[model samples]
Structure formats: structure tokens, C-alpha cells
Target: MPPPPARVPDLTALSLLVAIARTGNVGTAAHEVGLSVQAATARLRTVEQQVGAPVVERERRGRRAGRLTSRGVLLVEWAGPVLDAAADLDAVVAALRPARPGEQPIVLAAGPTAAEGLLPAWLVELRDGPGGQIVLLDTDDPAAAVRAGDATLGIVETVEPLEGLHATTVDTDTLVLVVAPDHPWAGGSGVDAAELVATPLVTRRPGAGTRASVEAALTAAAPDVRAPAPLREVAADTAVRAAVRAGEGPAVLPRRAVTGDLAAGNLAEVPVHGADLGREFRAVWKEGSSPQGTARDLLRIATGGRIR
Candidate 1:
């Protein structure tokens, strides 16, 4: 006997569900899906009923636990081929339609740290290569840009495992515990992970990948060491460094960001015992899509062809 076909979720609903899986917040996912939060909530409820599952979850160890159900994940997987086909169809229709007289340049989306610390230098070298232009779009969610066809290439810093796309590891960084030179921990050889988490270190906001990594490690190594919040939650890397330097508290940040300060005797590093919160810089593009011309050139330059 032939098996029953999988349920066909509404196209718009399925797309919204995928956005929820990507962003992990109904309101933010709603923004990405182009609906108001109220509308998104109602829509999600309808979809949940249609699919017979609860996809978005709740807090886990003081983190946003919103994630996809197995069925919701399946919907994301099923929606991918459809979205790709739609993109292809759009390309064909665009080809048949009258020319718009202006072409959309290739777009690049980069996380804040990578954009500030690394990408600019690499882009400077490209000035000698091509007359072709690339536009920069703002977002921390580089993988989302690739998924939504907003960018031909994207660079993201994330603690979450990379999935559901074609991506490459272009660079790596280690998170170090940085403190003001005069601080008590400065002379210490190392601080245990358990002790560090209990200290309310200066940190990025909850959703930032680096902070997420730190929380995950703390929850695993010593769940009892959890703090009510960060020592301080600042938006910018500069602000985080400034807060740490002001002797407010110690911080865990990428070594690249504070290596100069450490060298200048402004800050000191205390080893983090039992945890190495390493991070990767990824260049991502949509799965099953190929880059041509300048996009290909940029990928070669960015990754040296060693993409993961």
C-alpha cells in the first residue's frame, strides 16, 4: 500500500515557521517574516494546530529556549527546496521581464565583530581587483541573509552549530577572561570555569553567540554557578572593553578584541580552567546555490578555498 503524503502546510505559514526556527523569537521572527508580532503569534498558533506540534520552546538555564519541533524542523527542510525553486523562478521571470536599468549589486552580510575587526582589511585588498561593487547589509544573522537571498555571501560569528546551509570556516578565535591590571584576579594563574560564571562577568547581551557559548559551558560544568545576569550587558565591543577597563568587572571576549590592551598593560588575562570557548567566523551562502564571477572571487579571497 502507498503511504500517505506528508501534510502540506500553507506556504506563508511554513516560511514563518522557518523564520521562527532561525531567529528563535516570535517577535523577531515575525519581523523577519514581515508580519507584526500579534499577527505572527496568531499565525503560529494556526500553524501549530494544522501541524499538530508546538515548535517554539521556553527558557532553558536562563537562555531563550525557543526552537523547532521535529515536525517544525521537517517543515523547514521541506520548505527549502520550495524556496530555492521560487528563487530560481524569480530569476527566470526577471530575465524575461523588462530590464530595470539598474542592477542589484551583490550583497554581503557580516556580524558586528567580523565586520569591524577583519572584513575591512580584506576588502581593502579587493580595491585593486574589480570594478564590480558589493553592498553591505546590516544584521548579526548572516545565515539568515543567505537563507532569505538578501546576500550572496555572509559572515557570521555564532556559538550555535552551523546547519542547513553551505558554509565555510574562514577564521577562528578564542575567548579569554580579561580584567583591569590592578584587579585581584590579575595575578592569579587561572580561574576555574565554575568560579568565573559565578562572578557576573561583563558580557554581551543574552543572544550574542559568545555569551551563549559561555552560558552553555557554565550550565554544563556548574549549573549552580549561574548568575542572575551579566556584570553588565553592553551592545558594542568598545563599550564592553571600556566597562572592563573602568574596573567595573572582568569580561570574556575574543582575544583579538583585547590583545592590544593586554599588551599595553591595561588589561590582564586569567586562564579559564576547563573551558575553551572557541568561536568560528563563517562565510555562508544558500545551499544548492552556486556563486558566479565576483561572488566566487570574494569566496576564494575570504576562505582561500578551504571552506567547511
Candidate 2:
């Protein structure tokens, strides 16, 4: 009889080595794995010892900055298949237990405007047509959902790349200042950034995509003006609309989000000069992971084209 199989070593350390190799810095790799720099370094050392070879030449930055030794590359190449299989297994297991055969659930993270305005038409088509299972998660935490694999796709208003995720822009847009129709600034065709900054402004909490664009536009256009204390710092788009409608302060919102209000005469768009104040709406998915079949088809339908 063949001897019993030897116990396999922990692949966690091996995986970290791969991450470090790809990222080129411990800080970046550590963030991707949710590890502290010290812990990542220690793991790297441990893996090197276990392999009995110098797998990575660590730079002062403590990433795999130098070329991987032949042994290290071999270990990494061998481990790649193991990791791929494990990921497939996890995806399969998730698909099996709770979900029924016809219900192929895929979570999508997106901002409220996209969720409400953009996604529904495609979502209905997906459900009624070829695409069967679906769940929509409208959120500001697009990157987090993508990282957790809780979301198969994320539509976010950001140009910055999310670590470990592949991204493409579905749309490019600009922020427009919005105020209640009765407000003094209402009905103005458009104003320069400096003029727009002169009014009291309402803003969302920091890290909101619209907020970030608005702030950047304000800072560049009116550097001499002190940023007015925001009248409100809400999380959701609806709250921001309510505040502006109640005459709290002028608010900046995505053009898409405020289009209906603008047309309905409930709100007015104030122009900000000197700055473009644009944002990129993006679709993000896991690196090297393709959304095949229905998911792919639905994405194509939803986006109108592959991300540019």
C-alpha cells in the first residue's frame, strides 16, 4: 500500500508571498490581506525558512522588490493552481447550500442614484430574461463589498482603483450645485466656482464621492474663501435632497441624481466655474475573475459597452 499522504503545509504564508510579489510593497500587500506590516514581514520570514531557500529579496520596504529566486517562482507557480481551485470550491459551496437552482444570486454594490435610476431597467430585464438570480446592494462601501466577495460586481463613483479589484469606467460625469427653486440662487443659469462658493453649502459626510468632487472643486475655484460650515452631512442621497429642498443650504449632487428635481422645478442647478468637478462611475470585479454567461451578458447590457 502507498504511504499515507504527508500533511500539507499552511498555504497562507505562500499566498502572502504571492501578494507581496504582485504588489511590490509590504504596506500595499498588507492592506490587501488585512495584515499589519510587522505581521506580514514575520510571515514572509517564516515562509522563507520553511522553503529552505530565499524566495524573495526583500527591499528596505519589505516587499518582494527584488527578483524571485527560481525556487520561489516555482513554489508560487505551483501554489497558483491550488489557490484557484480553492477559490472555485468556495464559490461552488456558496452557490450550493442556501440558494436554489433557479436562483443564482449575485450581489451588486452601487450608489443610490445608480441603484434607483440606472440599475432597475436592466435589473428587471435580467430577472425576467436570461439572468435569473440577483441581489442589489446600494452602498457607498463598494470596495469593501468587492473585497469580501459579497458582491460579484460594484458600480462606484471613483477613479481610484480598488486594491485587488479590476475596474472600468461606465460613465464620466460632473457635480451640479442644487438648491430649492425658491432659494435666492435658484434659476441662475450657472455661476463660477467662486460665486457658487459664496453661498452657504450643505455637504455629505467625508468620503462620499459627490462630496469629494464638490470639495475639490470648491478648494480650487475659491481658494481664498473659507469652506463654509456644512449645514448637513448626511450619508444617503435622499437625505441630502431633503435638506436642500428644505432651504438648509445649497448642495452639490451628481447630475443624474438631480436631473428629475431640476426638470420638476423643485430644484435648480448652480454652476461652479474654473473646475470641471467630474467623476467617473466604475464597475469593479475581482482580479483574474471573469463574470461569464448570464452575468457577463447582463453586464454588457447594463453598461452599454465594456468599461473604457
lDDT: which candidate is best? Answer: 1
User: What tens digits encode model 2's per-residue C-alpha lDDT throughout 52-136?
Assistant: 7677775677555635677767787888888866654443334323555667677777765565445656655565567455566
**Candidate 2 segments whose C-alpha is farther than 4 A from its true place:** 1-104, 188-190, 194-199, 205-207, 220-226, 305-308
What residue runs in model 1 are displaced by over 4 Å at the alpha carbon? 1-103, 159-161, 305-308
Instruction: Give the alpha carbon lDDT tens digit for every residue of 136-238 in model 1.
Output: 6657688888788778888887646666677787889887889998999998888888888778778886556567666776677777765667778977667
Which candidate leads in TM-score?
Answer: 1
Question: What would you estimate as the lDDT of candidate 1?
Answer: 0.73
Report RMSD (Å) for each prediction in the order shown. Answer: 20.2, 20.9
Taking all chains together, each candidate's TM-score versus the true structure is 0.62, 0.57
